[model samples]
Target chain A: MSEIKKDLLYTESHEWLEQQDDGHWRVGITDHAQAQLGELVFVELPGEGDELSQGDACGVVESVKAASDIYAPVGGEVTAINSDLEDSPDLVNTDCYGDGWLFAINVSDESELDELMDADAYTEFVDE
Target chain B: MSEARKTPLYDAHLAAGGQMTEFAGWLLPTRYTELMTEHHAVRRHAGMFDVSHMCIVDITGAEAAAFLRRLLANNIDKLEAPGKALYSCMLNEQGGILDDLIVYWLEADYYRLVVNAATAAKDLHWLQQQSQHFAAGKLQISQRSELALIALQGPEAEAQLLHQLPSLGAQIKALKPFSVLRDDHYCIARTGYTGEDGFEIMLDAAAATTFWQSLLDAGVTPCGLGARDTLRLEAGMSLYGQDMDESVTPLQCGLGWTVAWEPSERAFNGRAALQKQRDDGVAEKVVGLVLDQRNVLRSGYQVFSADDELLGVLTSGTFSPTICKPIGRARVNRNIGNEVMVEIRGKKIPARVVKPVFVRRGQIMPGIET
Candidate 1:
């Protein structure tokens, strides 16, 4: 079965959000998404301070077969991007939920987080 | 568009963690592990791919040679002896490519052709229509739907093959490149899409599972189409739809050598148009491009001259596992110099233009180093 963390919030597009101690929300692709995308060769992420709208196309994840767009699940201002993935894209394959985190954002509206799926809802959604 | 077809090895693939994908109307494995693992396996050791989705065709009769001579751009007479293979482009009347295929002369009156899976139906219809001009009893065209093919490739391919079929050791060892070894069980051809020493084993579809298992038992890593594509792209082999299609001629796509112009007396399909193109000079030709950056160069990317003038469109592109760099083939202006730019996602990245061949037999070519 695909892993779905109980604490982290999920998006239908397969991105996960974890609240940082500093109130910034951390984002990364779920294990299910990484499995579907195969081993990633490259990941283009948003720069720090770039503003994004809900469901806006942000980055691209490219495997050998094809490229897929990464989306911003909720509108926010980009705080920090994962620079490690630039050199080690396969980190997403090995540890998609941990070190493979994409970017952290300072949300314009914290209410947007409630609209996202919880762990049980995302698990059911993925299973379906 | 309809329900995807499955190869005989479908269950075997699924059991091996093969990631399935729909390709050419068949649901085949794209990669069993990851693209890198399978791609490097073929470069360093032995790997096998279930290529049963490709079409296997047999042509026989008294006029088989005559029919093929007129049908293909390459001369069928060049086979010289039985079990010899010839790579030819079946061309339309306008000198456009119908499909690029490999034909093996099985005997005096029979030949075997392996064509691209995507063009199998169209090719069959064209073959059927063209064969009407030949005498009914003199030519017989049949699609060998009951056969299955597997490509065993890499440096250790022969060693692993000998481990399984030790009885045919001498025959397999003596088989030259582009030759076939035939017996009661299989038609083993020393031909492969990857630029590696390998065999394309054709056996009964019913026997596919057993053979696939035995090869696995011999330690041949089961590969999928993802590695197959990257390997062929690094080798600079032209893919049918990506590199050449019905809209392009052989001369325009680095297939001019496949067109047999010698002994000009025999007129093949698209002879007049090809000859006219040769005489009139081809405007664009396929060339190799190597990107120094880490980004991928994909198909449909625009090619530009140093001054940003549009030259042509890229046909095939990929990150080469063997060389660890981005390489691709493009149809650019014939008069182009050594330097060109490829526009990837609106950014023009400078690339070095060179000859198409990148890797062969696991050895990187002289110019492609780095």
Candidate 2:
């Protein structure tokens, strides 16, 4: 089972967002996402500072078995991208919840997280 | 519907966290642990694969030699030794491959043939039809679906298996490449599709489960079709339906080397056409391609020349764990230009030609022209 940090917020599509005290949120594909995708071969992350709407496609994560789109859990401005993945894409499969974190951002509205699933709820969601 | 086959290690795979999938009518593990992990394990150490779906047919009688000589494209006289196995293609009258098979010469009047499972029924039917063509002696073909097959491959395969079955280890140790030996219970062949030294063991299905468990206990990593495909492709081996089909001749599918044409009078099916192609020319050849970047290339991607001429389409493609690059095989016009591009998602990606066997021993094959 993937370690689901109780303090983080999640989307049904399997991305996790950690809210920072400065009104910004750190983003990364959940451990569940990487496990489902298998070995990561390619990643296409959105440009830094690119504005993303809620549920917008922010990037792509391709594993040997299949390719999946990474959706924004909530509206935000992409402040940073994980450039490390450009050369070491397998990080997504190896450390999906840590160094494999995809991007960070300034949240458009902190209240947007209300629609997101909490860690306990997300676990139940995946189990179903 | 007839029941789908199961490997002897099916329960063991489930226990060891392998994902099962249906392949050639058998419930086999597509991967254990993970595709890349299993792939690397085979290149680095020993990996065991359940290949029980392959059909084993025993042909016996005075006309067995002549029966095979006429039914296959390769000359059978070369298989003079008791344990020698010859890889050959069964061909149609039109020179197209019906199926590729390995024929083991066991005795003067008995031979064992291993064929693809998907084409088992058709191959058997064709063999039966050709058996009737013999006027002098009777030929008999028997299918042994009651047996299970396991392929233990990689650098450590022999040692791992030896650790499991010490008695059989001595018998298999002296087994030469492409040779087979049968004890009271198990038929062992030093043959594999992974381009590694290994054995394909065939034994009664009832004993298969125990045998598989023993190997696992001996530390042989359980592998699946995912690793098998990447391994075979890296070794430059052609898949039956992908690289060649009923409409493609072995000579045109990079398998001409398997056909024996000496003593031209040894007439085999499609011998005339193959000889003609040899004398005239082949129109196409299968070659390997390596993607320029990390982008995943897939089957059906069209190949093009520098001047934008369509050359061929990819037959199989994957991210090679050994090479750490994308590689594939394609049948292209025989004189296809050296430089070609693969059209992926409507964009032409420049690709370099490489002799297959992209990965060997957990490292990318070197000296390939890009």
Candidate number achieving the greatest TM-score relative to the actual structure: 1
Candidate 1's residue-wise lDDT over B51-87, tens digit each? 9999999999999999999999999889989999999
lDDT of 1: 0.91
Complex DockQ per candidate: 0.61, 0.54
| Candidate 2, residue B214: lDDT | 87
Candidate 1, residues A54-120, lDDT tens digits: the string is 8998998878887888899889999999999988888988888889999999999888888999999
Chain A, model 2: TM = 0.94
Docking class of 1: medium
Report the lDDT tens digits of candidate 2 across residue range B1-370: 5777776667877998887888778888877778888887888888988888899999998888888988888877887688889999999988999999999988778999999988988988998888888854577889988898999999888888778768877777888888999878988889988877788988999999898888888788889888898898888788898888888888788898888888778888998888887888888888889876787767788999988999988988887777677788887887776679999766798888767566654556685424
Q: How much DockQ does model 2 earn?
A: 0.54
lDDT of each: 0.91, 0.84
Report lDDT (Cα) of residue B68, candidate 1: 96
> After aligning candidate 2 to the native by TM-score, how far in Å is the CA of B278 from where it should be?
4.5
Off by over 4 Å in 2: A5-12, A17-27, A47-59, A69-79, A103-121, B1-3, B135-137, B168-170, B275-280, B360-366
Residue B345 alpha-carbon offset, candidate 2, angstroms: 3.1
